[model samples]
Target: MNRESGRYKGKRIIQGGRTQVRTVLYMAMMSAMQSNPIFKATYQRLLEAGKPKKVAIIACVRKMVVILNSMLRDGTMWDENMAKN
Candidate 1:
């Protein structure tokens, strides 16, 4: 496991390792929101800005992945509040 940005790159979530890919993805995103601080903050911010919860959650997941990519490339940990400007 490559530990770039405090995230396990090349990570995999096994759903029997072969089933329900979309469901697994959605659940994984929800889990990330619940456990990852950056994701949680983004999700809440979206909600506060009048985005629907489902839309916000999806956006959060997309943001999370983008951040992960950036961190992996730059070798940095997830920042809790870096974009508050």
Candidate 2:
């Protein structure tokens, strides 16, 4: 991720992904905040570590995407506690 500093350093907008998938993942991340403990904890931890809000949210998004991909590859259901790593 590329960051720029104008007043505050901020990650640049992510480019070159399918808009449909991006929208779905973003909504999933939002829902995960309310329904998933692991995601919520990761997000809170990142914020407390001084990451920007958007950066923390995106970190959770990436985590969810990776976890989802792993589940699909393994043909297994997600275990809520499995994503801690």
Candidate 3:
């Protein structure tokens, strides 16, 4: 949380990470939301659950990051069934 002028703010994403990587991931998420069924379904579910648009997009970003990291660590190709698990 951030405190300024005696007012407490909601928790926010820290800004210390690599901005370029973040930017690329965010853009990729946007495209994925359109073309990838998994991402598209997740994004739609979040929105249907009453999350704000930006919040849903950010959630997609986090999901994408996790999926990418796991794929890299395991050296596995993209698999829709694997993602379901």
- What is the clash count for each candidate, in the order shown? 0, 0, 0
Please provide, for model 1 over 1-85, each residue's C-alpha lDDT reduced to its tens digit, 9 standing for 90 to 100: 2334655465323235435765666688899878877678788989999987777876766676677688899888867664322
Model 3 over residues 43-78: C-alpha lDDT tens digits? 999999999887798899998778879999999999
- TM-score list, all predictions: 0.56, 0.80, 0.77
On the 0 to 100 scale, the lDDT of residue 2 in model 3 is 47
* Model 2 lDDT tens row, 17-45: 78898888888899988888999999999
Model 3: pairs clashing at backbone N, Cα or C within 3 Å: none
Better of 1 and 3 by TM-score: 3
Rank all candidate structures by their TM-score, best first, as comma-separated numbers: 2, 3, 1
lDDT order of candidates, best first?
2, 3, 1
**Clashing residue pairs found in predicted model 2:** none
Record all residue pairs in model 1 with backbone atoms less than 3 Å apart, i.e. clashing: none
